[model samples]
Target: MLIVSQALIPHQDGVTLHPDLFLWDKQLADRKQSWFHAADRTPAEWYASLQGSDVTALLARQIEVMPAATSQCWSVTPYHGQLMRDSIRVYPEGLFPWCSEDAAWLCSTLNPLLAEEGMTLLHSGAALLLSCRDALDAKPLSFAAISGKMLPNRHHEGADGGRLNRLMAEIQMMLHQQQPESRRQRGEVDVSGIWLSNPVAWPQVIIEKKIAVATRNPHLSAIVDGQNATVVISEAERLDQLVKGNVELPKRIVLTGEGYAVLLNRSLLPTFGKPSWSPKRVKSEVELISKLSGWIA
Candidate 1:
């Protein structure tokens, strides 16, 4: 199976992509394709669905399970940013740069504030985990999904909708006040606020075999079962290296992008004797990329 972890760097704005950005252009042209982006979802969310989980619950199984069943757990994503005056848009530059010492310090400063809500920050194996004493049945958007967007207001629907929004607002205020002067002298942006994802749970065991993966994404690598081959992860740029000569590529080819994905395989191929609606064959580089990215024009 070939999982193009990021098949295309897509734009939600309907901007067309250059064909050169497409990977392995000629290699998999003859193979069939079936786009899997019928609903709105990030590539991460789509992959999570394939694992029998959703964006909110995958973390419960992906991260190490703590024995405590009374608390809610989350993987922390501390972002360096400035919330724009627009009141709804966050600077896209708010990407988190993980520095062990810096992250630890930030958590220490913020832990006391989190304690007011019965939450604690834990630095575990390169992951900043958030554990809460009360059950939070709300779904927090992934940072990837909201990179170009803004955090949802408290009115966003969920069981704990109001609290979720309030918590984010509080966190933002705390970060602004607690930012250190050293980082400022370096002309670095403030570690203003955070966007959390991978809401893991307590005491539930997910058993999957170790899988072989090839990618540079740390978050993507952490969730895979390295000891088994059930889940295969690959990068869009390295599809050619993943395929070999004389042998056909794996039947499952998942072309994923920012908020969409397409499943390509022989099963979706047009059959001579059968009559069914099927997407056209990938005859050229233009068609190949356009098909994978859901772009036309």
Candidate 2:
């Protein structure tokens, strides 16, 4: 079984640490040698590399699979960003609490207005507002692409990137002008703006094994669909219960957002190490995938 978790380690500096994640980090330290350096810096890129899929394709497929669930063809997610001295910093989903109902109401109100500008809006998740352009000429956009340790200078970017950034600013202005009373009543954090993410296309891949996926990330589920796999969607806290059922355990299991891959057989474990730390540098996605190719053989 393989687990891919987000920020399972304190990959970034200055971000507030969660107590539960800190405990998980301690447990992982015992098996530090087993940890794999993420192929890409951000979780979005890492996930895209893992599935051999791009953000645009994934969002397109999601819209096709669940039309009612989304309102756009291109993938752009929203987030609550805070204005700093010189730039804006996006808040991670862990820092805020949002309800589905509020998200739905917000989207409903914004979609109609946004549609006037050749775009449709959807609430991808509590912390994400998904957007897709009505025209096919524009490239897909993502908030994860722009956000990082430093704030983005949207004024000095390429045409496509700049356009997307401008669109994001426009959406934020719209939300601010019409702040929902429901959100205010609930005393939610003042949503300053939105960040876009998952701006790639879904790839077509075939899995020969009877695989099962246990994750809360919709992208993970979309990747495994039509590949003779079972997807169990549940919150992070209740993931164990969701995966531990009476059915036969799959030969291969992937726990997305957990950050570790487990091979059930004893023989394969040693090829890597004793699950203890090594001074080796992190490997790229291609290298890591090549290393694990033997498992399929």
Candidate 3:
């Protein structure tokens, strides 16, 4: 099984705060094995690597293959954030104890407001950006997606080129105003806003292996879905149980997040260390893809 875990390895300064991950890293090092850094740093980029196709072409195919009942699909992820002066500081989902009830309530209340703008919201925080009356024949005006684990600091760097900036700002205001008093009294961080990433259609990929993907990330799950792989929506911390279950093991298993790759057959234990490719060494996605393709082959 091949496991891809979310940011399990933190930067040097974060080691103290992430003692558990730090210990896991040490265990991998003791075995003289470490995860190889892929061409992309974000989970989205890492997932893109698994697809053996051009991203633009893949998205186009998604539109072609989309069910007639839905006009378009955009990955919308909820996040908790704080307002620091004029800038907003978004926190990872792990920081909050969000339940399914919270997700459903937010979707139910917000979907109607969004529908007026030609979008239908789903329970998984996805929005169907509709363009026509006939769901089966509608042409999508725009396609967009976002990673749930992104930091507000990076989004401020104009990653989305200000496309969803105004939309997010509006959503932030709405969340703040509609935030429940009960939640505030409980000291939970406000479900402040959301971040939008990759605006593309889904791709159609052929599945050849019995692949099992263990992750709670919707973006990762969407990618794996294209490959027709079975998904186990569990947090990274609970991955050991999935890996050691009695069920038949898949040919490959991927854990997406802080980005680790473990060959379960070769390494009986989870290992961590410096990624094989450095930012300085691999400057482009093409180079990273080529390197990873060769290594995995």
Candidate 4:
């Protein structure tokens, strides 16, 4: 079984997070393409090697993934001052053998359930930090994604997908109460960017050039201008480079799926942070619940 550890690190302006909050070693055959074998190695240790040196990191203890049926099967009691406090069931009764397709299916099926409770499903893995009001009041919550991009795995892009935007909204709402603003003042903003996975695969100098393009591009100016904007990058190296500069620290930098990303800018970040549901999952569940003999909504 693959043991994954997630961390929620608070930051000066926001929070930094390791999104893979839920991890259990699955049989290697299940992760055929992602087959990783490091004897007694934790997820953090595995990810650390992939990210390289110079990046400070922390790894939490492994959280067991006990498969079960029912609405309350999977639950979490977050630490005091943490964002997660309720139990969230990613799968319903009789839904076992969660595969990559199932993960995607769950994203769409569960989003509405989450929205009903003022929450949503993100397209990335379960790793995130929340920045409320300011740096003094921030929290990070991590979880495993039902489906999304996995490093060293397949890359799939969706058109008009609003997963990132939805995530931004959830974060904003979580922090709105703590970071209230007066009338006529913008509460917060978010700047997000995507980094090419392979660009960093090149030499450091080549990767540096890409960062130059991001900061210099007209499209990126909005990121710097907003009081709260999240810069989402697909490449980790690019994010590391940005931190080295004096640019304002985002409220949260989230590396989701296969993209190196960040969500920040108080007002904008929340707006864009909202998450989207998975269409495939939702459609299938709706059909199953409608046709299954024992199904009840």
Candidate 5:
């Protein structure tokens, strides 16, 4: 099995992702396509599907898969605050570039509030992780899920979603109350909010001992594999290049994007007889995207 993260755009419209996205690579793209009908998810969800419970619970369980590994229990995201009228917006870490001092101070101020709800915030090596007195039933959205999106609406999700949503509100209020708006006006980065993962268990990941890993996710490399699969983790812009980099296909190649993943199952070995290009039907981008967009939804 091969897992390629960001294999497609989370919000792809009619346009082809890359020039050679599908038409140029029939061996992989047209092998046996299987698209998912579920809602979109963050790229990290695709990676965490590779690890066992121990490894997962051990990363809030996985942060856009996090800055570094830690034994700490609860995972948190240092949201780059972009306050809007009705809701807040979250930016990627690149815009904020969290500092140790900022993290420490934020923790110092927020820990007390967090303690009231049986939670503690700690600065764990360039990222933030929350520690809970009990197992948390609800977790915030994966940081990657909302990197440049509006904050998720207050939805009743998971077992303890009510409490989780309340906590998010309190944190946002705390930041704004602590002069974050002023700080923003002065052009300074502020950790005014945080996000956590829903802890998704990908029903899609195939457990194979003998496997080769290729990824941009920092945490998945710790996985101990034996050799039958080749997992490729790629950024949005580089999916085509990564696949092309390895012309040899595994028994199957799972190309996953946000909300959905497609399976391309075929023989692992390179074709021995007729070339894949013998009778290629290169459909116009319009035809392909029209059919694909339906299933992707």
Candidate 6:
């Protein structure tokens, strides 16, 4: 079963690092204590690094002894009984061709940790908040788990090139056109610009994505459009039916096994509240990390 865990990024001095791209920048990695290299590190060494126990210790605190009660203690699903819905932001830097080797390694490392507790890491799409909680605030805040990096194995050539570029150009255009004030009133816009640009992009497909979530609870939506880039959930009507019907939707959803991680924010939760959706911004840092532990297990 998949569970949600949320962590806050340091946004000091009005400078907040985009969570998705935070690990992509070598400069930033060099200065911080990030597990961006976990995938490449041997499990023995990786587990050794968490010895002192701060973050990992916290993770340990959240663990539980299974019914069989063997040597392996595991974490209970973090979001299992939690009430609040999460809103995640997936940065472009986490896209293919942009993620670094270490980023991929990190993902490989973390996957097993999740699996130990009976969960799998998915190459899913997510979204970010179109407007910061504080309009005057320059720092980025995430309501969901931001995918820090992309899978380095994916390729960007061939027919996919056309769709990728179109989506990219469209995102750039929307970022340029949609201002904070405008988006506030309009709420959010679809991230169709990126999908339309990808080479092998085909937006009509829906492969286990969070098409909609209830707005009454505050959530974002994810969907596949005519283009393949994965659209952001900006409207709540799609989710409205779901809410009326009552359902449990993933906080972060993907259009395909190899698709973008689109996030749904409160503004569009209403549509997701019904049952469905897909939104935007400027230059943002992106990162991608894999779960190596899963591979080992």
Number of the top TM-score candidate: 1
Q: Candidate 6's error at 28, in angstroms? A: 28
lDDT of 3 by residue, 59-109 (tens): 323333343444334444567765567665555443445554565667666
Residue 76, model 3, lDDT: 47
Steric overlap count per candidate: 10, 27, 13, 57, 12, 81
Better-scoring candidate (lDDT), 2 or 3: 2
> Per-residue lDDT for 19-63 in model 2, tens only?
333333333333324334332223333344445545445434434
Lowest summed lDDT over 10 consecutive residues: which window, candidate 5?
274-283
User: With candidate 5 superimposed using the best TM-score fit, by how many Å does residue 251's alpha carbon deviate from the native?
Assistant: 10
Ranking by TM-score: 1, 2, 3, 5, 6, 4
CA lDDT, every prediction? 0.53, 0.44, 0.42, 0.23, 0.51, 0.23
TM of each candidate vs. truth: 0.63, 0.60, 0.55, 0.18, 0.54, 0.20
Of models 3 and 4, which has the larger lDDT? 3
Best-matching candidate per lDDT: 1
How far residue 208's Cα lies from its native spot in candidate 5, in Å, is: 13
Q: Model 4 Cα displacement at 26 (Å)?
A: 24
lDDT of 6 by residue, 1-297 (tens): 111111123234322333433232232222212112111211111222223221112222222321222222211100101112452233322121211232233234344443443332221122111101111111111112222322112324545344333433444454344333433455433221121110111112222321111221111111123233221222112223222223433333211111222222223212212221111231111232222122212
> Candidates 2 and 5: which is better by TM-score?
2
Q: Per-residue alpha-carbon lDDT of model 5 for 1-297, expressed as tens digits? A: 455544444333421232335533556544645455323333334443443232334343323442232223554666766779987787643244444555567788898898777666765344456665556567555565566578788754679888878888888888777743444666787667777554433222333323355643333433332243345554444445445644665565555444445556674455444322111232343343344333323
Q: Which ten residues in a row have the lowest lDDT in candidate 2?
A: 261-270
**Against the correct fold, how does model 4 do in TM-score?**
0.18
TM-score-better candidate, 1 vs 2: 1
Local accuracy of candidate 4 as per-residue lDDT tens digits, 178-207: 321221143322111111110011011211
In model 1, what are the clashing residue pairs, if there are any? 59-200, 60-200, 60-201, 209-228, 210-225, 210-226, 210-227, 210-228, 211-225, 211-228
Query: lDDT value for candidate 4?
Result: 0.23
lDDT of 1: 0.53
